[model samples]
Target: MGIVVALWAAILGALAVAKYRKEAEAERTRIRDMRVVYELQLSREIAARRRHEMTVESRIRRELESESQADTAEQVAALRHELASMRGHIEYAISNTADPRRELTAKPHGDVRELVVSDNAVTDADPGRTEQQHDQDVVDAEFETEYQPSAHAKTR
Candidate 1:
């Protein structure tokens, strides 16, 4: 009876140890799975943060680009306005007859004979003068006069 009871005690102790070891292994596996899930969650959070940062940076770049384009447009508009003003000034200078000498020289005369005939014989009869010579003589005459005949000439 003693031998049987000792054998039964040994078997029961072995069974309890096996059951405890099994339960401990299952707990370890559960802890390992939980750790893996936590790591995955942390990685997901990091990825989301990176995506948000990228989005913000892209929006900033787009805004800066738009602002730069707007500035360029304003500069172009200002330049165009300046160009138009300069063109208008050039046109006015060309059209305004402030100097009678400049106007007379700009007129086409075939030669000195034609100029003398057109002037109604105001100067001496010099048939030897050419058109260019007559133009130079007119210019010299205008330079000799100190008093301006017109208001526009005085301003000039």
Candidate 2:
């Protein structure tokens, strides 16, 4: 009977130890899985941060690059092209609007006075004197006669 009881106690102890080992192994597996998940999450976060940093760095680099006139000659050429285009437009408009080479004479002054035409020698003045001078003299004489003050107004 004592031997049977001891054998039964030993069997129970072995079963308990086996159960404890299984539970410990399960806990270790759970912890390992949790560590794996944490490591994966950390790796993903680091990659995202690196990507963002690279993007921002590229944007900053682009902004700095824009400040420089790297293609100075090209830009100048483009501006010259634009100026030439504008000149072409202006030339086209001038050519289409009127005769570009035609000389434009200034309009003649108003003919307010009537001159009598006579083939006979009218005035023996210098031939160098122009008709405009004679007309101005005639206009002065006409203004004196036309704007003469009334006798009553003149006395006042």
Give one digit per residue, the lDDT tens place, for model 2 in 2-101: 9999999999999999999999999999999999999999999999999999999999998877765567767888987776665455444434433222
Clashing pairs in 2: none
lDDT of 1 by residue, 1-156 (tens): 999999999999999999999999999999999999999999999999999999999999999999999999999999877766654544454355443333322226553112111223433357776667766665444221223274446668
Q: What Cα-based lDDT does every candidate model obtain?
A: 0.66, 0.63
Poorest 10 consecutive residues by lDDT, candidate 2: 98-107
**In model 2, which runs have C-alpha deviations exceeding 4 angstroms?**
70-156
Residue 150 lDDT in candidate 1: 46
In angstroms, give how far residue 57 of model 1 lies from its true place. 2.1
Worst 10 residues of 1 by lDDT: 111-120
Q: lDDT of candidate 1?
A: 0.66
